[model samples]
Target: MAAASELRSDHALMLAVRDGELDALGELFERHHRPLFGFLYKLTSDRSAAEDITQVVFQRMLKYRHTYRDDGSFTAWMYHLARRCAADHFRRSSQAPHATDPAGLAEHADDRPHAGQHAASRDDHALLRTALSRLEHDDREVLLLARFQELSFAEVADILGCSVGAAKVRAHRALHALRDIYFRLQNPSRASSLE
Candidate 1:
């Protein structure tokens, strides 16, 4: 037989969490925290908020653990919870998602790839972030799910509570929008050259 941890799938670990085995949640956290933090950081540029939201995701997972269904994808369900956590955070705070928190950003640099440490890299990061931020909320979200998170359309549909076809269509539209924004930000005069 495989080792206990080796044999336990994500769902099995989640089921253990649901059964009041809180330690199981730590296992889940170890497995997912990096990606979860990355997704949140992209969603909310404020590193502090992203960290907070990541923690809240797990807290909600534990709070709502009873609702977990064996048939559902654990990661999809976790993302659904994370999306709501972000929505709630945005709703409570008046700042735009791309708004800055300089001190926090400085402190959080080691947690993510260094973006502002060099000139060329800084320009690249700034342009991409600007393009991403210019997208409509739903558009940015769909793009992030498909491109950055690398989730399948079906999993995205589950998280977004939409049909798989709708998810695919949204991602396609979002990518078009992102490309337009990127080119425009790169050079206003050269925007049409991208076509």
Candidate 2:
């Protein structure tokens, strides 16, 4: 026989929590906390803040368990809550999100066989992170949801509280914007001339 947890979908787990089976939330947390933290880390460019917000998100899940509904994806619902938590964190801090430090980017360096290639890749990643950080919060958010989080347009729309078409449009525009910023960061002389 399948274990109770193995038999339960994410929605089922969440629904169980909503119905006062609070321990079920542990399974959901085990399943989602890493990806949630990754999303928060990328969005905030601050590992400590991401860790803090991650805990708050779960606390919120417990506090707001009654709001869970059967009609939506639990992942989408979780991200919706995550977005609000991050926004609230930023608001309370009264500061704009910043780029990750170049040194910090080292933590994400690829484990390639070639040292030279790894260094180049690391630099490229740093540049991209900087470019992403330079984008407006909303643009960064849409890209994070659609690209980094790998959420479908439907789920992205659900989390963003928009129509699917609108979510796609936002993702499209955000990608174009990121591309422009990335290339500009790569070519400072050309960027200055074009400005």
Candidate that scores best on lDDT: 2
- Cα RMSD of predicted structure 2: 3.1
How do the residues 1-195 of candidate 1 rate in per-residue lDDT, one tens digit apiece? Answer: 776865788899999989988888988998888888878877787777889999999999999999999898898888889899999999899655763333344344334565457787766766777677667778888888788878889999998989999999999989999888887868967755633
Error of 1 at 174 (Å): 0.6
* TM-score of each model, in listed order: 0.81, 0.87
Give me candidate 1's TM-score against the actual structure: 0.81
- Residue pairs whose backbone atoms clash in candidate 2: none
The residue-by-residue lDDT of candidate 2 on 77-189, one tens digit each, is 99999999999999999987886665674553122335556768767877887788778888999998899889999999999989999999999999999999999889988
Best by TM-score: 2
lDDT for model 1 comes to: 0.81
lDDT of 1 at 171: 94
lDDT of each: 0.81, 0.86
